[model samples]
Target: MAGSVRLIPSGFEFVDDVWGGIYRGGSYMLIGARKSGRTLMGLQFALEAAKQKEVCLYFTNMRPKDLMIQAASLNFDIQSYMNHNLIIVVRVAPPNDAYAVPNPDNYLIDYLRDIITVVEQYNPSRIIFDELTPYIGFRNIELLKDTFLNTLETIEERDVTSFFVVGEPATEKAQQIINAISQYVTGVFQLRKSQSKINNRFHGGNIIITPNVGHTEGQFNFKYRIEPFKGVTTAPDVDDVPSKYADIKNSLAAQQKTAPHYVYTQSKQDKNEREVFNNVYNYNDFLLILNNQIALYKSTGQTFNLVSVKLNAMAQTQGLISLNQLQNSVQLSTERKDKICIKDNVLMLLIVRSNPNSVVHFLSRLKSNLPSDDIDYVETVWENISILNIEVNQDIENAEELTEESLNKAHQDPGSYLPVNKFI
Candidate 1:
């Protein structure tokens, strides 16, 4: 009511008549079942936004090239806009090739990092994040909440808008989670398939937009269909946020003082901000898991080798660059199930379900995988790094003993990779 509302049209004349399209700089959620035209609707919206001369960042799970082709098929010739960078399509995923990581939280961190990097680099006013099902399985409601909360904060800081897509949840609990999270957004739109009464094939679909912005009342719906060059269609990417790209981005004080009278009360920051990553583990977190495993092993008779990796000139704790370098080495030398803990120049690893004898071979070859030790963060050469191990069992009360013993063994030789320590 105070500031003017910049409405990004949804490309549908019927729906925009009442709601006045989607607000600029606001994040919105679009929920739909499979084949419910979620991707189509997002694509159409992106096309329309580009038409209004807005720079759009379309993050799709599909290849950017293929998404461009699909956009052209929808009667929107976007090639010129693509060349001009009016609509930049990016195939979004975590930085690491291995999607699965030891810590689920780490995975989310890396994914969020990717999003942040893209936003900072391109600085697009609008963003479209395609699907949520692939990343947030809805198996973890906490993960979903974290993803949205962080995304909202990021969008607000940049003053950009976004559209995050969520697949229709089958379970009641998931729907409940969605309902709970919805309070933080400016709007929630549900795209449902309106099937034909005759054959049950998709004849058309409907969109229910429940706008929280302005003096807009309860939700409303409209019918639509996909024909050749018709109903809807990059839709390449993950669940979205930017106040929404099609129709999304967020804030409370910001939204309140601005055009729309809506306020987005953010989810509490009660959860840890530690991101999901494929590459590294926070030392404290890894230590807790190590102790738990030690306790569990005492009864179960399951044992794991404790490899103490010492990088020379390494600080007591790892910073970002060094950690990423170490993470790169871990990716090259260790298995996905293996857990690494770094503290005070020593990197302790629990290579799960691995060969005791092959551990030495891994250590021998790992040196070759280290980044050029000449790099700035790495003060000394790789020659100073020592990889040694000790067999860990119930007798070892905690991780400290395991690492301490292995360090002693490495100190004994100081030059070459040592064999498994026989002194329990």
Candidate 2:
């Protein structure tokens, strides 16, 4: 029996960490939120199967064919497989002509028929449907689901493994539709966003794999990261940085002295040294705070703004003058504690739980704080921060050993898919 086929070498950390490998003859469903790397995840699996000299068919209804090809090439470097005829693409055009046609009800049927024809023609070992969300827009949900199930059954009988990418359900109705479809697939993998406790940044989501048809040798709930060039990668250790950035019980000590043009009315210290007021904090600390706020905002829809201020060389040469100027500006319109800091000579203001109107006012005030001669020269940037969720895979590092035939297949023409200019 062709029980399991390793899509990538076990030596590759991604294969070992995320998925032991995709099982042979498995129909999988990848479900994730919008822009959560669902399409990329599907493309990655398709590319891996194609690398084994297997015919792979990709079908997408979300993006244009040219743009999808461009993204696969630019982001994952998978264009060569398409060039070599190992990967075939089929784009499902939307029903723009449905309203004009005499028989508009046949749109779904026609679409599925076209897909089946392509699948039969390609005779691919692996098939990837870029998305299954568009079906929800159709009026006959039950019929579409029935047709989809029948299609999958036909593909399975032919020994062609398949993957279907579905957007994360937004409403109860959508969830019900997905639940109905989920029962037919061999496996269901949910991709979602998981915040890093250590860094407080959106690394990627935990992939929840629930095996259905095959023997459940390995299933997982693990964190994964979506990387550029390479699609998915195991995230760093969780405890790399403790979640201590938000432990600010008291304010950081203020400068002792004041600048000639700027004054800190809210400052505590009274030291005479002008150099003592260089308000810069460590860059890493800034990242920690930024990540923490991002996670906080994601959990609670409360808003926060990040304002970055970059000063020029003339301002830096004057020691604490630039720092005092920025501090005075931020303090005038923004909260002092837990709001303003200089990271690597750049001043960053964290407008906590504030809306857009107030943030704009704060930016204007900060701009006014700069020196009259150099006010126009200084650069200021601001953004409303939000959490980004990315889709990734699951893992089973020490799962059951593969059969000899499967192992032999993994080693055949190992680097055939690798370009000569792989480093490039």
Candidate 3:
């Protein structure tokens, strides 16, 4: 995408004038201490972007109706705006919603998929994420990066802009997450509460964009206030630096540098007499295959094995070469010929109508490939691979039982591989 011809206003005149507002196709972050008006700033930007004719996707944990009411309180009236497609509010509550409603059986994966689905369906020009704290802690870092962050590359390719709202970190670990998250975004803004009162005359709080995304110079030092109907406003000022900034010093430096981004594509890799073949599908697409197979099992009672394999390589090129070789093995050896899926370390194969004997033949064929060769790393050979599940003939049962018992077993148990006997 070309450099942003125009910028999306943050609904704050001071910020718009200084930092050039938000650039199109860029990812930005808004983090603040508790009650520092972070959500308000996010909402204000969504309203302003919508008014400027940008299709804005507003994701909030609040109920759709409640969020609309909140926006209306700030004079945005997002309901009508939503009716006209100017702004859309989607409720993406994390695990906390399990108490108020019946959560999805597979909550985390389903929720992430829902997010990607909405982005694809709406094709919004601007996306405002109200709060990312629920998903960005130390333990949840991989979960967030592996799923949602990857979707962000597609969002950038679409030339859409985004602002992620994050909560202030009270602990050292949480602060570390803030540092890690800053590198991925174009820049970060630290918002804080002021010692003064919340009245209009006094500064409501302060905000500063670290490593300013625009041409603005010097360390950002601006105070913000909440007007009766105008929402949050900013003005140039100086005050105690936000504690959040101290922890993310190195992170800001990293964002200022250049980095290479890798984009993964889905394409046909091999062909047969009947049709072309996909070497591997992403995990999300593989879910469709899994669901279809389960549906077919309900109808025809056919059995299949869910196999997960790993390849050790030092670089991406070597990994791709090994993956292609593995694909060749599957095509030449296995009874079924279908597109397999690989993500991170695991490559998944759906072996159809296969028993233990057939699985052994497939393994033997893979072993027949002999010692592999790769200069970038040690010889790239199969490692820690096993048939994770065998959905064979069983008594008639409901789909729900199958989902929780058979389908998710492999997903939950990545290390459940057992020793395999010699295929020969």
Candidate 4:
């Protein structure tokens, strides 16, 4: 077992309420359907754990290592630590490659040995198995079960706090896996794909905690949304960690400001006479508009890109330099019929008939036109600029697919922009 260590706060209200803080050697399960924010939540836990100066080992078969690092930068600057080797990411093959393809006969034992070897090598204080489903195959069920159970035993022996992610929460396989390993784990948190009765178009879900060893048992309904630069935020008003602005300015940088004064609507003749500007819509209206636009894309097959621009300087400086940059960006984009709106300090641009490539091009070009990227201004005001293609669909879980390609690009990398504190 690893040596005893000081306890650390998770920085999440729900987590703090549930367990106070993570147990030094506890094991947890995060079960959710695909795209249910499982990875997001797991990353949040891992990032907090790493920030405590504890060695953290993340085991994942889903997202690549680069993507995970890029996601972490949203909450706080972690590149220095990653460079120093405090956080370690372990990438392993999925079940098909690990079992069926490579070692036909010794699948379970081989993979089991590999996982055990990883833990033994790193001996990290925290271990996260992101989406364990890929490792637990249906073939040779009994042996695979034994392999998994043995791995759990090894984790317990190591006295390492662990997190396991399971996709397809509603499936019998998830249930079977849970029943088999639930006793060994300290707790289970499930994220589901559920719609709210209050708003039909908005996609969010409930998180249920089934008690086991170290945490209280309870359920909480939470909303989930992704910010272009911020990754996944459980709340609409705030993110899991501080926004980029917080890195340079005081805490006030994250406080919500008075809504910008703008006209609601106007007639065609009035629009021609006056400044024709679309009203900055609220989150609900943004969803409604996005839903309608998605439907339009389905019918027309026209490309539509959603670009979220955060005025990181909005709260820090009254000079409105960042706001002007946003306006100029919007003005340049509107030439192509791209409509813009503000929601939660982010200027959301609905680029009609433009592909992801063009959106990226425009934003990058517009960035050059902004005030010289001063180190202080860049840190406090100019944060990451990312554009994700919108695949207007009812399935929220699959929404990430829209940004899959962009996530791999060099410009989308976090190192290209300023890092910020976690928006707790």
Candidate 5:
């Protein structure tokens, strides 16, 4: 007899002492309040999978373009992935009665079928629904529950990992949706703010991961920061930082400077030195905060000239021209006169196009300054230029080899259509 097939664990896997672990294959849900990093966390998970060479599908019901820009701003390498067809992003408008009604039975079924079609086509290892709360708002609770269960069942059948982000409940109706989904989820990761017992001081939010039914629960505290790269850093160990830093009570007293009379009588010079030390301490703290924010932005996988170049390239690809085109466009005489330089980790193009109105005339000349690896980047810059405006006779067409329906059909019968190994 064949051995019984075993399902793999799909919970958090800690990478470092302070850095938070990752969620592997399984159906998981993230429940949190507004502005609580729900969408950001989903994006982080998708990015992590991408880094691991697993295809990711992101489905959004809100602010899809804004999310794309946010991802770009964080330096997520989205363009490179898009160019390679490694990631697929789709957006759907929220159902009209989804939030107002108790259940949207057929409507949700249709939506799920569409999603399933996409999944069958892409065969992504990871799928993320940015927020499911809006969908549950106006729909029937029972139907919503059944729909979620069906979705999970479909995912399990396909051996795909999934994540759903749900907002905090504003009413009993909302809570019901959360309760229903939580029952079927393979793991639940809850995010909530809490106060520290040791110092009686408020700390950051806590992340608690509860495995489904019989699995062990994992919990951790994480603080978001931006720096050399966008990623999570573990909270500093209590034993690592000086005890004085952790002692809020003593630290508050120190700020008040209400020590004994002997301390006050020490000297004016001593008091000045103490003031200097305090200033240094405050500055260091501020730097740490700024660094974290910067790191968070970096984690989005975008670069300084990312949006500008993409917009420009998209415009040119679409046959549009603007004032910005003159600067980025290369000209024959200018190419011979100016030099290309790589400074501060950025490629700079110096062009001396004399004719301001004829940016397209210099396209060939500018092409020389761009490296083969960066040609796509330059093309994207022109595409964005065309996207902005300025009509031209050039016929640019984008031919996609696959569609949602076809992709789904391929997945349903992989051996007959898709590559044999793709099913495995």
Candidate 6:
């Protein structure tokens, strides 16, 4: 905790033993697949350090303004820190088309040299590279690797902590470059998704930290939720206005309409009021209502008979239903006496035979009912379902064990298993 580089005190928590030595002047690498929250976590670190009045410099080769806005929304106290010159963000734009850094010999070296100049001018305690993989292509991995190691050495000599972020989905050559850089860094952090033991289900993701000589590994996972402007804490949950209300407020302001008056005021009262009413009659709400109706039908074994019915209802709610006369727009039928049927505005499914395995399979398929774009969300929901299955299986095992024990007792006492039916 007394090291030159220390994690700032925040509600953020780490799991297991993943906090490798983050001492000041050390070089650290953060690697993850795209959208795995790598940049967000790095920005959070920089913001936390700035809160402590430590000079922190952030360099971005991607997403500069978006990162700053996200940091600001987290109630990072950016203004206060900026007033104290504790935080500085340096944006790096790829060279323009006319003057682009051509298929490179050492273009990135020039960029790093400029970055070093900025570091020297600021003399900050902490420095971060948002991502360097893009700037350095696959063919130039070794050169980038060497330059990165050399930069680390220089930062260490100056007692400045250096943090670098790398993303995946790059060429194999880029991965090789990262692998080489990984060797020289004092610490490496990798974030990845893994299957859960509960049921071979996948969870969000966890971070793994590897430390250099004389340091231990660190691991952590983030469980996030939106918090009011105050900050994240564990005292008690606060009743913040939902996102729908916020959107309505923005719409009202854009239209220059008066916001609805509320009985009580909260933070951003005008904004929340505008959003609340706008969402009530929105098209999105109508779609949700129709979707809910469809869900009810599917859940009650009416899917086969009502498939067309549900689709028509959905199309009607979405204003996509046509009034044109058509004889074959919908159809219905039964196959193998299974009570399957479908027609316009009607759908049904019959389960004449039921067993544990078949029921489980049916439920699993039903659970997969989500839009294609929401695959990740579906996966998460399935993971939860798998965990429930594990719990049920465990309970069944416990019941069988109890029944065995009862039978054994009956055999020993010659009367323990006597049936109540006999007495009746």
User: Where is model 3 more than 4 Å wrong at Cα?
Assistant: 1-6, 97-113, 138-148, 198-203, 212-218, 237-424
Model 1's alpha-carbon lDDT is 0.61
Would you give me the overall lDDT of model 5?
0.48
lDDT digits (tens) for residues 58-77 of candidate 2: 88875545546645642644
Superposition error at 217 for model 3 (Å): 3.4
lDDT of candidate model 3 versus the reference: 0.61
Candidate 6's TM-score reads 0.46
Give the Cα error of residue 382 in candidate 6, in Å: 72
lDDT against true structure, model 4: 0.56
Clash count, candidate 6: 22
TM-score of predicted model 5? 0.49
TM-score of each model, paired residue for residue = 0.50, 0.48, 0.51, 0.49, 0.49, 0.46
Where does candidate 2 clash, by residue pair? 18-394, 18-395, 36-391, 256-271
Least accurate stretch of 10 residues (summed lDDT) in model 5? 302-311
**Could you tally the backbone clashes for each prediction?**
40, 4, 0, 7, 50, 22
Worst 10 residues of 4 by lDDT: 250-259
Residue-level lDDT tens digits of model 6 in 1-424: 1245543232123311123124656677888776555676676667656644457888886564577576676666454454334667776776443136455646657776676788887788788888865655535667777777677777777787777888863676666777877888876777664333213322235555566633443333343222334222112112322233344334333332342322333333222212121111122333344344345444563321111112223333444332210101111111222222322222222322333453344344344322222666444333322110111121232323323333344334433323212211
lDDT of each: 0.61, 0.54, 0.61, 0.56, 0.48, 0.47
Q: Write the per-residue lDDT of candidate 3 for residues 42-123, one digit (tens) a residue.
A: 8888876765666788888877666766677588777666644567777665766533545332355555566668888777
The reply for model 1, stretches above 4 Å from the true place, is 1-5, 94-100, 138-140, 197-202, 233-424
Model 1, residue 286: distance off in Å is 36
Model 3 lDDT-worst window of ten: 267-276
Q: What is the alpha-carbon RMSD of candidate 3 to the true structure?
A: 15.8
For candidate 4, what is the total of clashing residue pairs? 7
The residue ranges of model 2 lying beyond 4 angstroms of the native Cα positions read 1-20, 62-75, 96-106, 136-141, 194-203, 235-424
Candidate 4 deviant stretches above 4 angstroms: 1-7, 62-73, 76-78, 97-105, 138-142, 169-171, 195-203, 216-424
